[model samples]
Target: MTVALWCILIAIFLPYLCTGVAKVSGGYRLKDNHDPRGFLDSLEGLGKRANAAQLNSFEVTPAFAAAVIVAHLAGNAELVTINVLSVLFITSRLLYIIFYLADLATLRSLMWFVGMGLIVSFFVVSV
Candidate 1:
């Protein structure tokens, strides 16, 4: 598969990665499985930040996926361009998560904008 397509797959699972971090760090147990949302909601500090990042990841993933797919189907942009943007988006997300965990709100917000801009770039490149 193309790198951009692979990025779509990665984007789909990124939220799970964030949630996993939250669960592992939040002291989530088997009992918590019955009320996972509640357990997640109770998290504080890094766990809470991770959970928030997970939610944000889920929120942006669809648009990122759609942008990549639309870019591919349009077949107007160079493959390298699409792949680079996809990689950059993933990088931005990773940085965003790191910043969130570190409680660096400004940097995290900047990375979020970067990711969104990359998503928009995909559509622009397809045009």
Candidate 2:
């Protein structure tokens, strides 16, 4: 398999990774029953970020897959570059989720932009 395929696989597993993080953190139980709201809120926050990462992965993976197939079909020499970008994009998105869950808005947004830029670049190059 190509690097792009590996990156896609990693992206596919990102949501599971987020869930693992949540389980390790608290297993969905917040605190006392009196403060159930707080626990639920924290879980909600993590779930939102995990959903965001999954959405990003969904957005980029298809394009990366297409690029990989097309590159192989057309004998394009830039497949490695595209695959590298795919890896970088997924890695940045994983970090983005962690930072987002930690409430690091600026850094998360920056990482988001980087990931989106990679997707856009892939689309542009593929066309």
In order of appearance, the predictions have TM-scores of 0.97, 0.66
Cα error of candidate 2 at position 56, Å = 5.7
Candidate 2 structure lDDT: 0.67
RMSD list, candidates in order = 0.7, 5.2
Badly placed stretches (over 4 Å) of model 2 are 28-77
Task: Give a tens-digit lDDT track for model 2, residues 21-124.
Answer: 64445555434456633543565566655545545555666665665566556554478777777788778877888787787889988987888787666656
Best by TM-score: 1
Task: Give the worst 10-residue stretch by lDDT in candidate 2.
Answer: 23-32
Please report the TM-score between candidate 1 and the true structure.
0.97
| Candidate 1 RMSD to the real structure | 0.7
Clash count, predicted structure 2 = 0
